[model samples]
Target: MTPEDRFPGPELPDSGPRHQPDLDVLPYGSYYEPEPEPGFEPEAGYGYTTTSGYGGARFLEAHWPTASQQAHPGEPVHPQAPAAEDPPTIELGPPLDKFGKPIEELNFPYPQPEPGEAPGPLYVVGDVHGYLDELLAALHQQGLIDAEGHWAAGRSRVWFLGDFTDRGPDGIGVIDLVMQLAAEAAAAGGYCRALMGNHELLFLGAAKYGDEPVQSTAGTASFLAAWRLNGGQQQDLERLQTHHISWLSRLPALALEDGHLLLHSDTTAYLEYGESITEVNDAVHHLLTEEGADEWWDCFRRFTKRFAFRGDAGPQAVHELLGAYGGQRVVHGHSPIPYLTGSTHLDDGTPPHVPGPYIYADELAIAMDGGVTMEGRLLVARLPLN
Candidate 1:
């Protein structure tokens, strides 16, 4: 069956008045830890053969070619352009009010507050899907960075809802930008972090082992084939480096904050992996490090399931997830909003328009994917609903 057919559409009957949260006051949680910064031990120029082995063979080493043999011009080298000669000074400002928008008069998310208070403002970004130019422009428009491309949103928290690569050009470039922003934001007392999307695993698997055969529900399949079928771009794999693989492997698959359960997909399959957010993330991470091709393929397949919170059963399913994960609402990216509304976009990689993050499933779930590759818009908005 096609991927769309595999994941059935929401079965909820078209009845009842939809309920949406006021979001003026966000529920706070105290459980999450700071984002873990992880990277591979680089040997020579992004790709190198290693002596260590996992799964009874040289895991990543066996798949990559030597540095010189794998060179590609489209690859975005580090020290990303628009590199400012002087870094902009950052000043922690006041906390954002209930609306989740920056207090325009002060030009900050919120006024400076006492220690132990909530962070300035919380923001959620939808599926980027390797649109580096569009991603950069969106961030600039949101005041997250200045014209020279530096982290300028002091004391605000930005959570990327996943899908950093694939489809569009510069997937690796997009990752590098996010990584740089994470460090810069942290140093400035704010933070930028991301969730692990299925594309991440797909890209990693494709790069580490091109055509390794695997057992799938549809019989036999391979990561390379699956990725290419799912809009994976060639330039991304060509520029794939050891550090990128390591970073992607360590990304958490689930997160919770301000009463919203953050994840890459809107599927109930997460329950099959773990009971809690931490357990889910840990289980996925373990799979990456220890599992074989078939296992990884299965993991990727499970992640592709979506529309769990759609039909009459959606609210109940969402409630069950919240009970397990500790959140009042689910915020995710993967299934683009346009698909739900049956809306298409223009030819020039831009949506005719977007109503913004499609809040549905009786308002218990928020969808952020604007399907940039399909010419839909990229969504980035502050959290705490109002």
Candidate 2:
């Protein structure tokens, strides 16, 4: 189907609001997506607030409790023991090159590509969120692509765990590189693929029907409001094209590789949609094709939920999710790792310095969102955890 057919504009009644209202109808200033659970304070060191006043500054603050604090707060909801003892993770070692002298950063120990080799290893990238330069640097550091932004890893597989757009500059540029690499990698015997991040859905909806009201449990809402609230960049929206929209609509919601279930969000809500991984992906993709606004909104809302595999009952949640979907562990990106590390940020308004992927929740789930937008590391780690 054509992109327009797949992403039809919102259906409007005869004499009501326009199906796609002009941007002039909305407020002028940059909008910030409100933090979930207003008035909810984070554990101790990692406190956050949405009402920070500065546009989108609230996103810089940390929220999720560290593994230690997981035992409290949500105890009633997550009553089970932690997933697995925190895996023996490699500490964020020193930086590969001197970016700064303040925080100690661990350079990903990317294996050098052997001469005339096929793909070297399986690696997963954390959220890109429109940081094209950082994403390029990270991939180069991992030796997945060469200096010219071409797929350099002949046989190594690299999977970006979603969130390719929004919040930063060049979201579309990031998607372009990924789409190019997917083709380049396959031609050379390797592969590159992406999951459908919530932002992708937001972009799709906003482009198709800006300001058109969609029914929600809370009331009538529009993708334009939700997108802006979530740090949508107008530049990204302006540069958005039909090809990008089509690419997004076709992205799978979940995948399983080498026993690791790669997903965009941490919630078990994927279960609500389908049983197996393929089934879940198909269900999500199918929902996006429908014309109803509420269905699409509900799909976006479900993918936006986080921390399902956290808290006291985190292990049980992981077990239940694995029981349904095939995977020894769940590797996701939506939730930033530093937020769960606890000792990340101080009260000085400094961004948390993440060294590597935060392996917590008894190691049953691996959080890859290094919080790049939050001034944390843009994580890229190999598979089959060492």
Candidate 3:
């Protein structure tokens, strides 16, 4: 009965193949609840952009066309009423986008979003794969927090776009309400900081009292068996072992603020590390503050890989992460615009029915993975929206 109520999306014109997939690996997810619930959408949210120059870095987002759907590109979503039986998946095998048809009817021109003095109820989240009541009903429908689980009460300024943990089921109560609303948005000045998800580098590369070690050039992959085959939820890994995976390994794949730029997993391997976007997010937070979580699990194994926006390398890998991270636009969360607009894939473990909330290339880039474990929908907003 769902698959976006049976395929209700259409708007092609971007197509694929600038591809870039290879931080190399193997991969794989589940759950709990504590409180918080409502729905989400007050202003706007999501991140990761770096294109412009080199005709958008020529092309490179490969890895067997990211498993399949033949590396999706526009033209073939004509379903509107006939493809609804499966909708709950966790294939984690063949689907990094190539499932196709939904470029958002091309019309690129972008560049007119620089008018901030800072009054935004700032929000940004993606990759809550555990769907804790759809991330508390999108943070109580963006009142930012109310209905229980305290915070600025509703001051809002949240940011998160990382794989808080595999699949879904309270990835530790969504990292305990984003570490208690980044300390109630810096005690109400307003702001939340989160970034570094490839399931937080596959839970610090399978910590069995680990000091570090989650190597991957792609072989024998073990972020604890790809975090228990993609839906890992052993009581949210013992409540993420009382925090301090070195403060989620000092997160920072990217972030700019106000002008927008943030990332979780949108690949292009941040252009092999640096060149701009503040030296590629300060050299990927300075090689995770100087390697050794198995040599930084191959840069969190290619920033938790994803289809460069599905086929013909989706708008030149979103213009090479928005021209090396400048961000007039680019808001990511690994690959979850229902796995980049194919609408639904993943076959047995289930989840992936989205045909709502999107902007894409002309908007410059904004996906915000809202497939919340499969019930779909766990997103928040707020940011330069008019």
Best by TM-score: 2
What TM-score would every model get versus the actual structure?
0.69, 0.71, 0.29
lDDT at position 150, candidate 2: 84
Compose the digit string of candidate 1's lDDT tens values, residues 1-386: 53223322222222222221110110121111112114423234222112221001111122122223332311222322232221111222222233433334422333343455435456788988777777877676566787777777776778898889877767888987887677667656667778888888888989877888888766566788878866678988887776666667778888776677888887888899988876888788889999888888778877877666654556778898999987788889987665544454434534433446666666677788866666556777666422
Alpha-carbon lDDT, every model: 0.64, 0.64, 0.52
Q: Mind giving the per-residue lDDT tens digits that candidate 3 earns over 131-199?
A: 566666555544556677555333334678777765555666666567656655545544567877777
Assess the local accuracy of residue 3 in candidate 2 as a C-alpha lDDT between 0 and 100: 27
Candidate 1 overall Cα lDDT vs. reference?
Answer: 0.64
| Ranking according to TM-score, highest score first | 2, 1, 3
Instruction: Give the TM-score (vs. native) of candidate 1.
Output: 0.69
**Where does model 2 exceed 4 Å of error?**
1-43, 48-120
lDDT tens digits by residue: candidate 2, 1-386: 53224322112112211121111112333222234344356555543322222111112112222223222211122213322321221112221122223233322223333444422356788887887888887777556678898877765667788888777678889987887777666555556778887778888888887999887655677899978866678999988766666667778888776667888887888899888876787787778886577788778777777766655556678888889886788888987665554444566866565656655556677788877776666777666422
Alpha-carbon RMSD, each predicted model: 20.6, 16.3, 22.1
